[model samples]
Target chain A: MPYYRCVVPKDSVPYEQRAAVAKAFTDIHCGNTGAPRSFVHVVFDEADDRWATPYFLDGGNRAGRSEEVKAELLSDLMGAFREITGVAEEDFSGRITEGPAKWTMEGGMVLPEPGEETEEWYSHGQAAAGG
Target chain B: MSRVSFNCTMQEGQIGEELRAELAAALQQITQDVLGESPDDVPVTFSDIPSGYGFRGGEPSTTSLVRGSIVGGVTQEVREDFMRRICDSWMEISGCTVDELVVSARDV
Candidate 1:
């Protein structure tokens, strides 16, 4: 489970840009990790003001992926956010925190580790997507 | 020191005050039943992300997140049971589908 929370100044990001960033993140995450698209959640919250920058990406993903993959994922996600919203590099910052896969449940099943996904997980995702 | 606490976030206006109360009670009950934590001692807070601010798979999101923190770690089986019960009760009380909820019970 990868949940991306975009913490930005109030009303700083319009609906269009938010949608674009969400789509880009979903694509980037799924492309890099081979995870189900439905498992990716992106939310924009304007209530957080503790960040040093006006824009921030607070991401949470299931633990166990390689550090290289995690770093690249963050970089790609931030890149997409900037490219879509035109936010300057200095105005944006982010980090992805991880938790054990066994600790969370999505769609009624306990999540499998990064490389240990079975057909059941994929099928459940597909069914959730109405495919 | 409470043994469990839950932080629930949902889309604004999706659940009414009445339903929220029901959901909170359900969470506490589940905590007590599954983890043996006292319902009165369990802390459950709810927040709303305004509409147009939440998305799933690049579209507007109807999903809600219930994150629980356990003071002492439980086995995988207990964790799964905790999450499953939360998901079932949340969907039943909130009228949301299984796909619309994400439940996590993490050990501290």
Candidate 2:
């Protein structure tokens, strides 16, 4: 599961744009990793004092992307935030983390090992069932 | 190369100064040993969650959650070992159950 936890300032993003923001994150993640949209999980939380200054560092997970791919994802995410939240790039920041594939679980089923995703999750439909 | 961020539920003053410093050092060591990243570069973030705001299984969560990322290609054994160390530290420091202290990692 290429899950992402994005913490934005409270009320930074308008209510109507929330769904599209999630989709944007999913698309960027899937495009970079070849993971299906169904397996992507994105949660947007409102930041509070608990988070250190520059709450965008809240965190994210990546599954074997090269630096180029990671950059692309980050760029896309920045664009999404700009569009959805009307926030400037200089004011917004985030980090994409890398995780092992075997640790990811969905519907109580663990994903195939890394580098085996092509054989197991080849398409959106097949990737969903993870057969 | 690997960073682990913990989004947890805790009231003010729940995680003490000594425990926080210890946990940070432990995680840095794990990242250095397991992922070959410099302890200095291993980024760790801890975000607090209020009790009523987070949930597990439709019930209000009484425990904390930790989700994070690591550099790709570390062996499963190493990953598990790192996870166990971090989770155990969190449990001891926060008094949260193993079940409540969820920790997962992704590779970049």
Q: Which of the numbered candidates is closest to the native, going by highest DockQ?
A: 1
lDDT of each: 0.90, 0.57
Per-residue accuracy of model 1 over A1-131 as CA lDDT, tens digit each: 79999998988899999989989999999999998888889998887569888999999999999999999999999999999999999999999999999888888888999899999999998787663
Worst 10 residues of 2 chain A by lDDT: A122-131
In angstroms, the error of model 1 at A34 is 0.8
The CAPRI category of model 1 is high
Please write out the lDDT profile of model 1 over residues B1-108, one tens digit for every residue. 777999999988888878988899999999899989889999999999888888877778888999999976588888888899999999999999988899998887
* Runs with alpha carbons beyond 4 Å of true place in candidate 2: A49-59, A118-131, B1-108
Among the numbered candidates, top lDDT falls to 1
Q: What is the DockQ of candidate 1?
A: 0.85
- Per-model interface RMSD values are 0.8, 7.2
Q: Show the colliding residue pairs in model 2.
A: A62-A97, A98-B70, A98-B106, A98-B107, A98-B108, A99-B105, A99-B106, A99-B107, A100-B107
Q: List candidate 1 stretches off by more than 4 Å.
A: none
Worst 10 residues of 2 chain B by lDDT: B51-60
lDDT of 2 by residue, B1-108 (tens): 335443333433446555666677777776677666787876666655533333222223344445557656777777676667667777776675544444565554
